[model samples]
Target: MRWAPPGFGGKRRSPEEIKREGWREQKVLVVSETDPRLTWPERELVRQLGDKLYGYRKEARHGRLDP
Candidate 1:
């Protein structure tokens, strides 16, 4: 997901470098179950869906997703 400059060898790129490089970036929303607006079941469903989507997104970004 990242490439280093020629003649520059070291550990993997840091989060700062990744951001500076302008790679695909996403902002995740945080919703707490404690929010009175959402019932318990609704919160659970949202949490599960968010987790699944995150996994799929990460895999797709790294070219690991299946056809």
Candidate 2:
């Protein structure tokens, strides 16, 4: 589909119609480590990635539960 040029074209129901110039989305992945569907390796990788990006969790840092 040809994207329309960026401008006011009245309110659109689906924003996907307009061409979003220079717009990049910052995305987050949400998952539960204990989710039954995920395997051990997948859960471990997710845990490692979280720690690498955000540092040690508050629970581990303070020796107490965060929530």
Candidate 3:
């Protein structure tokens, strides 16, 4: 979206146009604990999936929850 000016009006820009503004190059996107893309259950599902594919975290080792 652009600013609404006297002559020019705000219009929705295409994804490509928006990308060109700052995402012209490849970027590294970090997904942290505070990531908003998923709900709590969804994140838990991903954690479970990873445990199945890889292994449990150190805190979850040997059926214990010690940190």
Candidate 4:
């Protein structure tokens, strides 16, 4: 079962809950390999959000949230 790292904001989410929510494997790429157009703040936001963003993406893909 998967679990969110401790201190994730919002209601606590267990790994099993995340899987049920349709979270999938994600490949991590070096920042330079990511979109060159992304600004520093955008990159920082992505770093800060991390897996939470993945969860959001999963939720969106599953229709749990509006795109």
Candidate 5:
């Protein structure tokens, strides 16, 4: 799976479009540590990536690096 920053693809849809497509809004960021398809090394990589993204997101939101 690929991850991208929110709203990169296009503008917001109208209510009619949303209903027609059955779109649902939810939290955007997700880190899964238990994906069975990932090999041991890949899982480790994902964990590290998740850590980095989380830290960066925290810093961006709070204007300071995580301790």
Candidate 6:
């Protein structure tokens, strides 16, 4: 099951909506210094999907989802 936004009345949502939901999750992947494996396109995809991206090892140390 999933929680939809206030205005989502349809049976399904677009990938952007699903990705946006993933960004709202309580956990996520955090990288340090930007992984070389993440190509420009891949990075852009993540950026488009996520609320924000951080590069702080300190934050990662705490957890990927910590505010």
Model 1 residue 28 distance off true place after TM-score fit, in angstroms: 13
Model 2: weakest 10-residue lDDT segment is 17-26
Model 4 C-alpha lDDT per residue in residues 1-67, reported as the tens digit of each score:
6677768755878755655455345433434214567888887676547545444545335645543
Question: Measured by TM-score, how close is model 5 to the native structure?
Answer: 0.35
Judged by lDDT relative to the true structure, which candidate is superior, 4 or 5? 5
For candidate 5, lDDT tens digit of each residue in 15-36?
Answer: 6565545534542434356678
Worst 10 residues of 5 by lDDT: 23-32
lDDT accuracy of residue 39 in candidate 5:
88
Ranking by TM-score: 2, 3, 5, 1, 6, 4
Could you estimate the TM-score for every candidate?
0.31, 0.44, 0.39, 0.26, 0.35, 0.27
Q: Who is ahead in lDDT, 1 or 2? A: 2
In terms of TM-score, which candidate is stronger, 2 or 3? 2
Candidate lDDT (C-alpha), each? 0.62, 0.63, 0.61, 0.55, 0.62, 0.58
By TM-score, who's the top model here?
2
Root-mean-square deviation per candidate = 12.6, 9.0, 10.1, 14.9, 14.8, 11.5
Which ranges in model 4 have alpha carbons more than 4 Å from their true place? Answer: 1-33, 51-67
Q: What lDDT does model 3 reach?
A: 0.61
The lDDT, on a scale of 0 to 1, for candidate 6 is 0.58
Q: Is candidate 3 or candidate 5 better by TM-score?
A: 3
Best by lDDT: 2
- lDDT of each residue in 1-67, candidate 3, tens digit only: 5566664765678755655554545562223333577899877877776667667877668765633
Candidate 1 lowest-lDDT run of ten: 58-67
